[model samples]
Target: MSRIVILAEGSFQFHAAKTAVGVIRYSKDTVVAVIDSTKAGQDVAQALQTNFGIGIPIVRDIREALPYQPDTLLIGIAPRGGNLPAAWRWQLLTAIEAGMNIVSGLHFFLSDDEELRQAAEKHGVMLYDVRRPPEKKVVANYTPHRAGSHTILAVGSDCSTGKMTTMLELEQTARQRGLNSAFVATGQTGIMISGNGLPIDHIICDFLAGMVEEMVLDFCEKYDWVFVEGQGALNHPGYSPVTLGLLHGTLPDAMIFCHIAGATTIDGYQHCPLPSLPEMIRMNEDAVNWLHPHHNSKVVGISLLTHHLSEAEAHAEIQRIEQETGLPTVDVLRFGADPLVDAIQRYFNA
Candidate 1:
């Protein structure tokens, strides 16, 4: 396993640097340090206000993180378009010069970049682009794959709304209950954590659903319960296609709607307001029905992201959402995924 140093730089919040947070929380590799100038000289868990990376230190740059002897540098900045920021070039160069391999999940592949490529070649380091799609072509056949398997997909109100986190937590809780389960990663962060999954967003648009369907078929054949990770948002102007593709591809028997507790608009695109919980639920259900009329998939639960709320406030919000949606709901990371998992178990049992 690679000894890693995460480069979050200017973006190092729990919600902002999800790639950083996910790696810190779930990766098997050792994350020696995080490069965040703003939060330098602080504990990663303390800086992110989470209990994941307890002793991991936050430093100002690659040079500072070098003392930890990290052979790999992870670019954990998740921008709107996944573009490589101009300011981060020097940091990558510095890491490459120090003979550290670079790993990035951005759409902008560093290996394809001429300057970074030449520099990496000179230093004998590799550039691993996690989001690059496979060369093999695939297209959707829309074959229903849920004969003896249970497939669950997490749909979100907006991007970075905790779909991956919710599904991961749910999978962990399900395994403890002695159920045969698998977490099907769909994003780069999830792929990095699980070490095997196609980046749903990076796949070609025409082949998106087919690739997802292909993956789901493989997993359903092995695991009785397949929890496919979600991407983007169904109602989002920027990322709706990938969500739609994943929904159709996975053919989920049930979906858990994910949303940040007080969010009224799409993050980053604040001009686009979010729909009510009920309306969003209806939208996803209708979408599934439109694609596969015979499939009985519906939004079975709500995964509320209440990290922004206090404990008392979070409980109140969870209660309110449960009352509002008339479905089991909980903040997966904060309160555990028992409620949502129970709801799924109840649905399948009945």
Candidate 2:
């Protein structure tokens, strides 16, 4: 595994710093340090406001992190447009010149950029643009759906509201109970962690569902349960299509609706307040049923991201969602995923 320094720069928050957040939660590799001048000298736990067990330092720049001897500098902020920020160019070049490989989740391919690519080559370092879609020759065509294949997708109220986190915990808890489980990654961070899965958001809109269907079908044979990591949100105007496509493609037997505890609106769209929990639930079930009328899929549980709340507040919110939606609800990270896993087993294990 690589020793990585995450470059979140000025944008390390719950909203824009999902890549960094994902790594802190679930990287197989060692995150030696993080770079964000704004929060320099703070430990990652303090900076992110959540303890991820390891004490990762936040340094001012690449030069400060050189002593850690990191092999890779990971671009750890997934900004609105997925473009490399102008402010990051020099930091990127400096890391490449120091012979550290670059792994970026940005849609802006660092490997395709002439100056950055040449610098990497000169230093004998590699560049991995994780969000770059595979060549057409390798992208999968839609496959026939299998019967009795249990899949549960983690759809969300907004982007970066713990969809991947929920799916991952569900998989972990399922295996702890001795069930065969598989996780299908749908984004670059998930791909980085799982070492498998296509970056579905990078695929063209036309092939999105087909690619997702192919991914689900591939995993159906080996695992008793397949947990598809979802992207974006159904209520997000910018990303609803991707959410809809994934919903149809996975055709999950169950769904976990993910949401942040106090988020009233889409992160970037404050004017567009989130749908009521019941309304969101209705929309998801309607979308799934519309996609596959004969298949009766339902929202099995709610995976609320409660990292921002107090334990008492988290529990209170959990109870509220359960009562409101009449479904099991949990903060899968703060609380174990047992409740949601029990819901899944109850619904699908029969």
User: Would you estimate the TM-scores of all the predictions?
Assistant: 0.95, 0.93
lDDT of 1: 0.90
> Which residue pairs of candidate 1 clash?
none
Off by over 4 Å in 2: 137-144
lDDT tens per residue, model 1, 220-312: 988989998999988999889889988888878889999999999998788999999999998998888887677667889999988778999
Q: Residue 34 CA error for candidate 2 (Å)?
A: 0.8
As a whole number from 0 to 100, the lDDT of residue 163 in candidate 2 is 92
lDDT of 2: 0.86
List the lowest-lDDT window of 10 residues for candidate 2.
136-145
